[model samples]
Target: MTDKPNESSEPTPPRTQPVVSGQAAPSPYDSPTGEIPVVKSGAGENVPRTEDELGLDPEVPGVGERTEPIANRPAEEPTEPVTPAYAFASIPPAPAAGEGGLRRRGDYRRGTLDLGLLGLRLVVGLTFLYHGLQKLAGWFHGPGLDQTRAMLEQGGWKHGELSTAMLSVAEVGGGALIVLGLATPLAAGAVLASITDAWLWKQGMAPGFQYKPVELESILVGLAATLILTGPGRLSFDRNRGWATRPMWGSVTALVLALIAAAASWIYLHGGNPFTGFFD
Candidate 1:
């Protein structure tokens, strides 16, 4: 009773505990063993292992189960190679002769000038042949031999008859020979003589060069001379036979004949006549 002391009336004091230094408070992320719990986010959260990673035999089926990785599979095999549609390639081997014999290591050339000569020959020959037919058949506006003779007389050709005959023969015979690739040099020389004579008589000295002799006949004479100097080439019939390959004496004879013809034409055109001094 000694002042059972208003125990109920006394205020309860707060309980105090001893404090330890450097000790941190426990968090919800802390584990019982003091290790932090790892919570991965995004694609890395629930990735699976493959058969090779799990040490399973790849050859055995169903013996070991594994979650297959989507990216771990091998890529699809590529399709076989194919030739293009526009390609002109052939599978069969080309013929041996088609290659023009076996080319030596240093002998092959990517381009050639010989083909140009062949092309020229073909074009000129065909043109002359067509011209000959025009004269023969009167297909175009070309004059016949008789009318050509009259024109030659008007041009002061004293022997107009003979000149006309020779021109007709050269045009028809030489053109045919050229087209056939036979006696190419002779045919070219004949055509050259006729054309040269025509230029000198009709076009060269004419007033104002009305017919354009220097422009047109110069190119014609050059082409004809080129053909005369160079043989028709390997693709021609002359090469197939041994006849066209004549001795140097043949060329010398042709040269002499050409000089004489040219001199005769000059005398007829400008010098009146070689034998007579009177002008036409």
Candidate 2:
């Protein structure tokens, strides 16, 4: 007998489907629409489809389809645009001077200078006050107003008694004000005028610069003028009471009044002609 070769009965495995990231691949043995599974035959192989199944797509064999990979899919919605948020910061302002007892601009209230100036005011003011008392009230062995008037007449004052009395009043009043550091400009003006007249009187009568006749008067004028330039010290009544005001215009006004008073005093002393020549 001739031996015929028997056929081995193993079925061929189906081809693998291509995989996408977010999508599932169709099964190899599944129908085109993936609705039904293919059945196996007695020979252990996929059952062949009928003409009706092939009618759906003549070229493709199973449920597997040619599609774009998940990496290239455009189904994802576009990301939303981001917006930034902001908040305003709050800042505080500095305190004002008047509100907290702070100094204003141009206020010169140095402690050391105030102490020195206060000492100066005391010495000058008290000395002038005493001298005024001597003339006005005959205190401290002074030539009373009557005697002072005679001395003034000898010095060529048009009205010696009136002039001497007026000088006494200014000296006494101004000296007291200076000592108290009240109305500093007014006090300085009065004292400045008085000293200016004294200097002119000495220059006119003495006629020569042999000796500095108005030495004490010049010193007094300098001190008074300095006080006008610099306000009273912190230890005075004016400062404690908030009256120690020293503005630029105040100084200017004090100087102008002093000069006018000096001119008037010179005129009263010698009939408006105190000097004989330019140098004199």
Candidate 3:
């Protein structure tokens, strides 16, 4: 008999299957909708397997891990710092009585200035009116222009008649205008001219302290200058006509003009006069 074949030592033949169109073999990780199956190791092993173990993103932390819902994050809001309501309020009170007293004193000084200006105006007006009337009417021992010219001729004026007439006109006309506070600068200028003339011509011979005629006139001129510089106080027609609120620069102009006029008068009267040398 032929040697019996060793059935236990026989080699197994390879099996083959036909390929199907449009179909794939099911994967070990395949699952139905809405569920993921957990993978495990071979039998009797305790090790767990995850998608990450197969080099895939793990869904254990939940799906769409990178695309977090904005609602779950903390919100941001723009806020401004709160400030005290009275931080920018008015200035606080001064701590010293001296400051308060100084403020009050300043107010009082302003009031006094106003009152002094008013008084000066009234006195100048009355005095001018009186002298003007005396010269115009030859009243109260006032000499007529002809008599004044004769007197001035004896005192060394070359053109006595013209000088006397001009003096009378300035005195009367300027006085009336000053009293009315109309064209006050012109009036003051006229008065200044007359006073300057008296000081240079007639009064120069008189003793310094004797009943010097020009002394009163000089004072009057100074007062008139003050009025011209400051303008007629609130009681005058200048104020009523809205002409008295002159700029401060006008005072400078007035002062400059007055100084020039004064210099010119002095030069004209005394520059060539031999008599001025005697006094000098």
All candidates: CA RMSD (Å): 19.3, 16.9, 17.4
Q: What's the count of clashing pairs in each model shown?
A: 0, 0, 0
Q: What lDDT tens digits, residue by residue, belong to model 1 across residues 73-137?
A: 77879999895665675786567753646543233342554466577677667666666655555
lDDT of 2 by residue, 182-242 (tens): 8887887888888788777776666555237777877887888888877786777778533
Clashes of 3: 0
State in Å the error of residue 162, model 2: 1.6
lDDT value for model 2: 0.76
- Higher-TM-score candidate among 2 and 3? 2
Provide the overall lDDT of each model, using Cα atoms, as 2-decimal numbers. 0.63, 0.76, 0.64
Q: Give the top-scoring candidate (TM-score).
A: 2
Higher-scoring candidate on lDDT, 2 or 3 = 2
Model 2 weakest lDDT span, ten residues long: 271-280
Evaluate model 2: give its TM-score.
Answer: 0.59
Query: Candidate 1 clashing pairs?
Result: none
Better of 1 and 2 by lDDT: 2
Model 3 C-alpha lDDT per residue in residues 158-269, reported as the tens digit of each score: 5666666666777778777777777766676677766666655545565443445566866876887787787665555776433354526665576567667755755553
